[model samples]
Target: MWVRVTILGRCLTDGQLALYRIPRTKITYSNIKYDWGGWIMVGLESECGNGKRKSGGCQARCAADGATARVTAWTHTGIVVCASLALVIGAPARAGTDDAAGNAKAARAPVKPVTGRKKPAQAAAPATPPAQPGAAAPATVSRAWSAGPGTAPAPSAGGAVSPEVAKMIKFAAFDKLSMKGWITTVPPAAESIFQDPNGLRTALAEYGIGYVAYSTNTFTANMLNNAPPKPQTYQGQIPTTYSFSEVTVSYDLGRLGLTGGQLSVGTMLTGTTWEPLGPSGAKFANLYYFQSLMEDTVQLQAGVFYNAQNYLGLLVAASMATGPQALVPYELGLSRQGVPAPGANFMINLPNNFYNKAGVQRSISPDGADVEQQANPIGLGLSSPDAKALFIDEFGYKTFSSPAQGSVWVRAGGLYNTSPYFDFSAGRKTDTNWGFYAAADVQVSQISSAPYEAYQGYYVGGFYMTSDPNKNMYQNYYEGRVYGMGIIPGRPMDQTALIFGYTTLSKSALDFQAALTGIRPFGDYASVTVSNSFRLNPGVYLMLGTSYNVHPSATPRLKNSLNFMASLTTAF
Candidate 1:
């Protein structure tokens, strides 16, 4: 089988074959052959001595032919894979006169004998392929093939030709592919509180050690000093001065050879005195890290946490740099009052950027030793000291988001304070308590040219809880609240919070209240809270707020009272 080959430098990009072999002579043909397994260029005289082909090699020198050179053929060998995860082939060296006419003379390496047992013959390479895209073209690239029969050189020895089909390729190139935001908290410029107070927090976070602390000192003044009007009336009982502070340290144990989680510990430090208004301390806000899963789709959280939104994300007790406490969720911090307990939280990421979380923990003492007893049965939500209590909470979120339009989230949460707190018998309390809530959180920003108000947040929620009358507290109660936060235009770092809340006690509780107050005080109670927080800077902030309360319609179950509170807060 004889064939002609185009030597394009160190590479052979094209090939053709001649059907009939021509004896040692100066002639060329284009009929491609396919049986001998290799394309033979200039054929040598077959010196068959005793029915076996002899090694009758040929030699040559440069001839004054301006067009082509000598041709030396090599039997197809092995192919090595190439390119950047791509493919390329190194052509075997040819050594003989190689020219288009097949007889041009030139000096090359000596020919060697083909030995060993004959193996199955595979077809030699056929057509030349185009240069790789993005590759710099050499001064001499073989004829460019478009696609069809006369265009692309036929397939290679590997069989089917890697046809050089024209393609309209598009791509992109960037200097780098990296970005960053929200390291530990907002950077100083965008934040008014705890802006990396000491260069320590920022430095530590950079080093994978994130530590944060916050302190809030609040002083309240009542225009109408009044105790709960009726013995059972749930009204303003705020103390004059109270302070709450916490410090949390999170260590990225991944740096210490531990993996998949960070170790965090938070301590409440001191407990508060008042029942309703806060500073209510329950030490060790958080004790474990155990964030085993971190993916958006599913996550497993174990360790100690604030337990519920009340003492966790709710800013009513402590403000977050993100925004104001626009909604005052129920004080669901009974068992783990501003404290952290051993528990596990699981989160599932749903479609459309929605998510759900559920968690449970030993009410207080894992061994049922000391379950935190409530100070005001109503305020503490039925945490009994005799029986073991298991706090269970589940919450879900559905969100609508847009950079320009801002974001909105619809949230539903339910908690089962599974503890028998009812006074069924003189000595035994067997009633269980539970509550549920649904709220919407909205935040609009001016990231883009949307007509959304900059720095605004609004939230409204409805809450209901099963109360016990024999406990001298609320019996079957329900409440709702609406609150909002917005930056007064031109008020640098200043924000305002306006909230309204209404709670109605069940008839049983109302009846008890009527007996205590002598008059059947209506079962309804209402209050309005207004607060303005001025961020002097990232390290300091001042908040002045007031609450106006209106008790039931009956005799002064609780007279209208106006309370004002001032707080100076700082964070690190």
Candidate 2:
């Protein structure tokens, strides 16, 4: 594992020579300083091979007045190791390219570099970044491994990373990370396997590799309720709101330049701790690809179809948009229930305020839910289909006003799904026969005058689904939402919202319930959802939310269901 050497030339590091690659020479070094990036010469010669001084060879030293000059003898016999050289070697690079591809054999047990967490909503974006990839320059070394530890830091038998290589390793391992890595010694506080996903993602992205990871735990418990087939929970029927972790990794082949077309393939996973690589909760784990054409203006996406966070935004503008539209849903699409879904879907979008999507999905029996049926060489869970369906949606965006003229953005879209998740007694095969929804949102008041990103917005929409008329889930429904983002002056991370909506069940559904159970089930009922999200730090957040059914039943019309929840979200 020795690195051969031959002085290639002066590294034009603005006069710094951290690394110089020259072929066909064995490893031998006398003095090497990563500080201010010193110079090193390479030749098939050594004066202090076994600590025995030979008479005629060159001496390396830190020029007394910095890069301006040098004061050393070309015929010194002993290796001249600079005191500063020890400082830089003992410290690792904070950011640079990944380890060279040729050094695979000497690789140590892999370092965990989790990145790109798709946090629940807007939180899904990568965590707070350290610095852009291009900005990862030679950072100033503030401290060194000069004392404390009994053993001084040393590279593996493969030799210490050149100041250049060190930068690359440091960049990939711990660039822009909140939890710094200790090259000289292991930091005492380093206990968790999860490091900074944002930093790792940044480093990878620099090399056209994509990375994302995040974990979430949310609870939804009824304060008062009396219903059969209760929720599954350790707390006696309390339903877990959402508890899962997910990751996405991708690489752009177009950036390589040799390829004429731009293409990127990404793999995403959502799973529990027991099965970290397995797909759970709506079965969103799958592979997808992205293509850039027409000079990056138009983009295409296809593969396992999972509705991205913002199918529509009643409050937040990004991924965590509230409502049933967000969250990669299992019971999503037209024929399915109100949730996101997974299947092979295709979508197209661009910066011109135009976007379109279409996809087909088939439902599976609850028995086939947890297990994945593999396909050919590299596909998962492609063998189950309980309900066959297709969905299509197109939308356009327009700004009614500008930031300086008072912010107002309106978004409208129409969606239709031919989903058959259920069958009814009179009209069709299922209670949820077909569904069509048209929606519009207004970014009413976003105080651009404020010191932070502040906003007040609302939306109104209607949805209609058909059944056997005797057993309809939602005949025709209207819903509305009012939310504010970062509106509390300096508390820019805080978001508050109140969502109220009504779903009018068909008369047949009510009558059918009465005849079958001797009790009239809920009819045209209303519900309210409220939430407050507090961002502890840009990377961590806490959410407090609650939902209640105002009219619990049709005939009795009693105030019956009240649910409350709390959650801690981490993006890494």
Candidate 3:
């Protein structure tokens, strides 16, 4: 067990004066008595009370008499010590083994008492102006096992687990484990009380396993619609909700003697309350896959997964009002999350922050938009027989891993689908179908320090994509965006973004829309979206946004539509 001592007159932020881990054999009744010192040390110890001079056990002198001593301990049984039991455990004289010279050296160590406490006059006025109403103080973890008395652990890009999983209750050696936020009697700030009821969630983290689960539910309503009555409504004025939940489990292959290897699998559940939501069914976001890294220079992944999971990822454009329009060129028929096809990815990490990645995945049928999703909701079966293979490649320069120096990512990629399709406008069959896209994002301004918030800043980026107009309904796509996080004075976890996008529709797509609605379709479409997200708690977030669509394709009679949307995402 380890004992932490606090000197009553001092005000250490963590309230720790010294910490000592002592073995069981060195303990003595007299040693315990003097070490505790009646809850305070009055003066230098002249004797060990055992009538012998001992180097170990609490041996300290106070500059003044009658100061207090406080001791706390974390024991083998996961119990924090009671004050009486703490005294019996005894605080060691100093760090290291019993030695007169070491104790003397520790005795002479200086204590730099905090000098920042306010004076009477200074205390009368606020040192810093107060925040406006509803403004929050930076969040602090109050659980005992948090990093410090009131400090939270560094934010991680991962999820949480229950305490029981940290150390199987029956194992004595593992029972004494010390982990941030894992041994606490109360739930950590990131988790709800009801999570991990069975203790199986975090059971393998100690063995190099990892787990993450989250749910994202979004509600959208089209407030205005202007179009000639149509066979299919344009998400017209009806509110709908999209719900997606997923859990992923990963293992470090080092545990099995394979260094630099990682294996992971993800299962997802999704549904929609009204209009079709993207990928609306239960499925495997990504099936079993193994990734290997070689000398930090080359990486490879094989098994069932999506091309989009490996390439063309962007943080600034991660959240949009409608879909992945600005971040992913879905029109190119590359495999995606929840409907990933079998594939392999190879990447070479180049010098000076450059990299190249290439992949090939089974392309899903493009005849009907939801044919593959309906036939393979589980994502384990083969893609449609009519579907062919899809090849994709990308090259990029990024500084995401070293953000303190600067933050920027520039990339370009192309995709080719080996499938036949008819020209959208000419009604001619074609076997050649391909597309190309380029994108870049750069952080223009800094917000908080890198540690407090690395990705919080003003970011600007643009994307342009072009495909074979002969066979694709959308000839070209363009988008520009500005994203900012932690911009508010006290809300380091808050974010705001604005995005603008445009798409040109082919004549055949317009003709089909005209046929369905009995009116000519709009020639093109443009939109602007604005959103703000707030971190309501450690692992929960709320986002509200709105989008204005000009020249909406479905309803050509009305020139525009206004839509509102909100989403809640929770992590566990």
Candidate 4:
């Protein structure tokens, strides 16, 4: 007997036949017999015949076809049953392996059956081994298993994140930023004294709520008065002290699903020991505000607040220079420092570091100190009948590269104050006042690579301001300064500044001064100031400086004067 047995229409190799103990018998006669545990008759044409005598070749063909069909069907049935059992038992174990390793990539790949696994609640489809098209028939055993419709799929250990979740994660990262960028330098202190010991501070920051508080005290004394028109005027040359303290709370609106939005509420307390410019008393300053940033290109702010630096002068606000050299001399009726009022401001960032900004703030009393006391005590008073509206706009360009690469800021702006002002020469009340100003600051030397050394580099800066001589006491103001940061080793947060200033007094002011003193000042006023500011720790700061003025006539009749000043600042 010649028996050619195959599974799935493909002949088995010799190894497979031997493993199954299937005999490989060959015979020339059609009638042949093979015996296993029981005597079995095969290749018997008569048994397969349908009541007709057939040829030997026909009989052989018929017998072979019948045997092949029976064997193939039986082999397929056995394979399917065995594969289903393996998949049902091994799925849980394979899922466990994938989850423990946290390999999302592996989990996505085609699954393979392995030994020792829990049976799935629902049965999977018959396994299908991978095979190439147009290749020999596949082996009966399969390794790949796929879950049926009712079967629950395994959860991912570490997998793809949704777009919404990714965006939120990114915003949270930027929400709780460190203040190192705003600080000229960060001290060596590990943490602030106000830091919460219970980790509540950090926890709140993560959720977008934060707190800040700081205080600054400044003192100035006129050391020498060259000429005193009135002997009683120079009686004490008493020292004057100005103090300002503020506390603020900020909340990120992103937690409420409004991205790039923030709400801040703050209050400032201000006082002065002596009166050179004030009704002087502790009063509340404007500090409540709402801010929104749109796609890093535009920003909007509105509330009872003030930001002078944003309107016109960057160098003057940032410089360590003190006294006259630091003054930009804009109209006082507009929004001035320590005199906050209701306002709205906007900024649009342009390409190549260019930007434009504008603002409208309610004008307060011209007297700086009186605004917070007599005019707007709680930053909400409108009792001052002299109050008007202030409009300001500016265009600027800036470059802020790495500390070692240097930075530059240049800007020009104008302000229009609707408040009435007395003409200096005519002594007549004017309807409105307007002025223009420009300022620039450039890093003049290479900087060091220190964590606290952001603006810590040599710098040169200047500012110019001009107004109508008839209406303004100072017709024109000019100031130039040079700054050095971290000049002393181990004090990377220290800064020193040398400043020079010139002011051309209006004719009316000169004439009025001459009438009172019986002598007219010859030339414009000039001042030279040198100052040093350094940080003692993360929360403490100190500044010391001396200023010499020539032909100083803004207030008391003085041909010349020398003044010394000091300031202390603490923050949390």
Best-performing candidate as measured by TM-score: 3
lDDT of 3 by residue, 1-572 (tens): 12222223322123322222322222122112111122211111112334332121233433333333432221111111211111112222332222323241112212222122111100000001111000000011111111101111211111121233122121211111111111012122224322443644335545655565667676766676444444323333356566777666677665677765777777888776532235667788675555446544777777776555466653233322234322234556666545567877788889887888887777766553377777676877676755777888899887531123336678899988887766666555667578888988777776544222344567778877778766676667787877765667776656677888787766776676577678876676677878777767655667777778775443444547676777776766
Candidate 1 lDDT, 1-572, residue by residue in tens? 11223221111212212111222222111111001122222212221223332122122222332222333442221111111011112122222333445455633322333332122211111111111110001000111000001111222333221222101000000000000111012112112243334544434544556555666565655566665523422222433444556666666665676544667666664333333323254555566655444333555556655454321222222211100111122223233334344566666677766666666654542112123423222222223343344455445554332222334445566655454544423334555545555544454333222111222344444434443334323333333344333335554334555555555555654565566567775565565666676656545667666767666233444566676666666654
- Per-candidate TM-scores read 0.53, 0.52, 0.64, 0.62
C-alpha RMSD in Å of predicted model 4 compared with the true structure: 28.6
lDDT for 64 in candidate 1 is 30
The models' CA-based lDDT, in order, is: 0.36, 0.34, 0.48, 0.46
Tell me the alpha-carbon RMSD of every candidate.
Answer: 25.8, 16.9, 14.2, 28.6
- True-vs-predicted CA distance for residue 428, candidate 1, Å: 4.9
Off by over 4 Å in 3: 1-201, 225-237, 274-276, 314-328, 401-404, 426-428, 449-451, 507-519, 554-558
Candidate 1 residue 282 Cα shift, in angstroms, is 8.2
The prediction achieving the highest lDDT against the true structure is 3
Question: Which 10 residues in a row give candidate 3 its minimum summed lDDT?
Answer: 120-129
In candidate 4, how many Å is residue 11 off?
A: 64
Residue-level lDDT tens digits of model 2 in 84-180: 1111122232211112342212212213221221111000110010100000000101011111111122233223343443433333222212111
Return the TM-score for candidate 4, rounded to 2 decimals. Answer: 0.62
Task: Please give, for residues 89-171, the per-residue lDDT of candidate 4 as tens digits.
Answer: 11111111112233222212222222221112232222111110000000100111121122222222222223332322222
Error of 2 at 113 (Å): 39
lDDT-wise, the better of 3 and 4 is: 3
